[model samples]
Target: MGITIKDIAKAAGVSYSTVSKALNDSPLVKKETKQKILRVADEMGYQPNIAAKKLVSNESRTIGVVWPTVERVALTTLAAKINAALEQQKYHMLLSINPTKTAVDLFNRFQVDGVLVFGEEAHEEIISSSIPLLYYGEPGPATYPTIDVNRRKAIQLGVRHLVQLGHSRIAYIGDLNPQHSNQREKATGYTLGMEEAGYSHLHEAVDSRGLSWQAGYQAVKQLLSKKKPTALISASYDLTVGIIRGIKELHLTIPQDISLVSYDHIPEMEKLDVPVTAVGTPVQTIATEITNHLLQLASGKKVPPAILDVELFQRQSSRSPE
Candidate 1:
């Protein structure tokens, strides 16, 4: 059996009841004594019986994250941030890579305080649960409270920036699959931005067939084979990375040979060969917002759907076409 509070109490020279209070962080225990007990417990590698605690208090103090697409780097980063945020509020985060319905059902059985579902392209059948639910992505037909970033506006920001820089022949590279609503929204924004700039005839500039680095590389390679645009806007950070590689392989340079802008707000973009100009809601902000809403729901408070705004960060990758 794992080391228990009683073992910790023996090590710390405290009563079992005192150790239990200290473990629960009750104010009844003196601060110095509590700290001593905690240190002893840590040194002893005492693992608390969470199942027993849950049975006694009827609360697990845990949050379930249902992420169907765990492979997406952006989602992985956001989930990590959310985990940190939830930890700050003394809640443990449990990730489930199972199908959405299955994960929801499993979390319900575990009696987690709340559940957060990450959006995916796959349509999921609804599963009822008493646990409060929060969704992060396109609202769609979800009955749960959703927090969505303005992806269309994000793409528009990048497109408009290129337009302002006198890049009339602008191209967009992104996933064109009809089922990918988020990518579709960004593509629609690109069309709107192009139309607004009176470049409606340049519809051929948009390539909506892929979201991976290889897809971006191949898309750019194909574009170069035909007629390269003055500037290119990528729908995601991974695609942008591939675009940069494609440009390099073609003996082209950013902003000098071909200007580029990408979607998604991440600090790592700054470390690239050229600090990429990005447009989207910051991942940290999204994580914090989702965590706060989940906490509110766990407390039995109602939360309305939230739509986050996006912003453009102009960096070295974009400039007026030569």
Candidate 2:
């Protein structure tokens, strides 16, 4: 049998109740006593009975992350960051790739402290949930507290920056699918930014269809076929990479030939051949905000839905178009 709290209490010369409070890090236990008990517990190889603790506290101390589109590379990175943040708080993170409804039900049955849903799609179908629910993208019609990055503002920042660099002919490339609200927001921002700059006719310059690297390459190829824009705004990091590859294939140079700006803010963008200027919330910020909000919900605290702001990080890729 494994070493239990009672065994540790005996070894530390404390009551069983005192050992329990110390193990739980309760304030009722003196700091010195708690430290000694923990040390003794470690030396004795004492193991906690999680099942019993859950029964007593009525909490699993676990957060369920319901992400239907696990294949999305950006979401995968965000999830890893969130997992690390939760681990630091002594909370476990459980991931489910199941459909939204199914994942909600599963998490409800498992009685997790809270559920963080990853996308806006199919959120309308989730009419109700027994557990606290926090959404990570567009809130849609759900009543749950939602947290979303300002996708539209991110694109606008890129467009405004390019315009300020004296680039009248600017193009945005990304997935313009109406089904994806996030992409739609970015596309709308591109149009709005152009209109705001008194270049409303340039709204047609939004070349969008897919979110992949090939899509960005093909879109740039097609755009170049007609008339090469002075500057290009890619809707995503992967798309930016593909756009760069396409530019090289056409024997063109960035900034000198065609300035570039990307949508998502990621570390990899800075490490590219030419560090990319990007506009979006940093992954660490997004993860930290989401994790902190989820913890608040788990604690039965009220948290208003949040639309996190994005910022522009200028780097080597952008310059005045010659």
Candidate 3:
């Protein structure tokens, strides 16, 4: 059979409460006695029931991750990394694909220590909850502590890199929805980059209907038909992939006919036939920051909204325009 606090208490010659405190590593327990009790508990193969402890302590040591948009492979990988990070601290992670309101309510009922929300698009309506909430993107009044990347800066960096390569005529392919603050910031960055480079004629904003390769293909094809850009700045990794396929279908080649840069931090993008020049914060870093912030809040430490720094990785997909 298994062992329990009662067995540990008997072996340590202490009360069950004392054994419980010692096993939990509570400061109230004497250190020497706690160590002795822990050693005995280990010998006896006693594992404290977290659920039962939660009933008494009112702390679950569990985090709820609300990621409604599961289509993004990059996001999934980041979430997994964050989950592993949290696991190191003895914190359990639970993910939900439910919408904001439902997810918030579910976490609330579960009495989770904190909630990490990842939304595809920013929302104006605030979600009121007693549990601490950390948003992964832009901040809304609903959540206080948010972790956002400098998307505009990243895109601007991409544009500058292409400009330095002597590409004067460049086009930007991005989703133009004004409600999506992240996309808007990227578009703004592209425009700022083009204008700053004194190549205002190259500023073409083709709207990708969605953040998919298909949307990218359709938008790029339309742009090529009207006016072919010598270089292209895509807003996301998926769009960049679509744009590359579209270009090839139209009998164009990377860095030969049309150079490309995109805003993403995906590993696979580098393994493409022509490595894509990507500008964004590393996924691991971003994921760790978000996870750390949530854990800090859970431990009653105050955290403020943060904007992560983006890194530009120059690759072979971009070169001087012919």
Collision count for each candidate, in order? 0, 0, 0
Q: Which residue runs of candidate 2 sit more than 4 Å off their true CA positions?
A: 1-22, 25-50, 120-124, 205-208
Q: How many backbone clashes does candidate 1 have?
A: 0
- Candidate 2 RMSD computed on C-alpha atoms after optimal superposition onto the true structure: 3.1
> What's the best-to-worst order under TM-score?
1, 2, 3
Residue range with the least summed lDDT across 10 consecutive positions in model 2: 119-128
The TM-scores of all predictions, comma-separated, are 0.93, 0.85, 0.85
Between candidates 2 and 3, the one scoring higher on TM-score is 2
What's the candidate order when arranged by decreasing lDDT? 3, 1, 2
Candidate 1 residue 201 Cα shift, in angstroms, is 1.0
Alpha-carbon RMSD of each model: 1.9, 3.1, 4.0
- In candidate 2, the residue pairs with backbone N, CA or C atoms under 3 Å apart (3 or more residues apart, or in different chains) clash, namely none
Candidate 3 clashing pairs, residues 3+ apart or interchain: none
lDDT of each: 0.86, 0.86, 0.87
Candidate 2 Cα deviation (angstroms), residue 265: 1.9
Which runs in model 1 stand beyond 4 Å of their true positions?
Answer: 30-32, 205-208
Candidate 1 lDDT, 1-322, residue by residue in tens? 8998878878899999999999888999999999999999888888878777899987788999998665566777888999999999989999998988899999999899999988766455766889999877745346679888899899889889998999988888888777777778888889999898999788644464766778888888888878878899998887888899999999999989889999989886888889999999998999999999999999999999998999999999999988
Candidate 3: tens digits of C-alpha lDDT, residues 188-298:
999999999997876799999788888899999999999978899999888887899999999989989999998888787888778998899988788789888998999
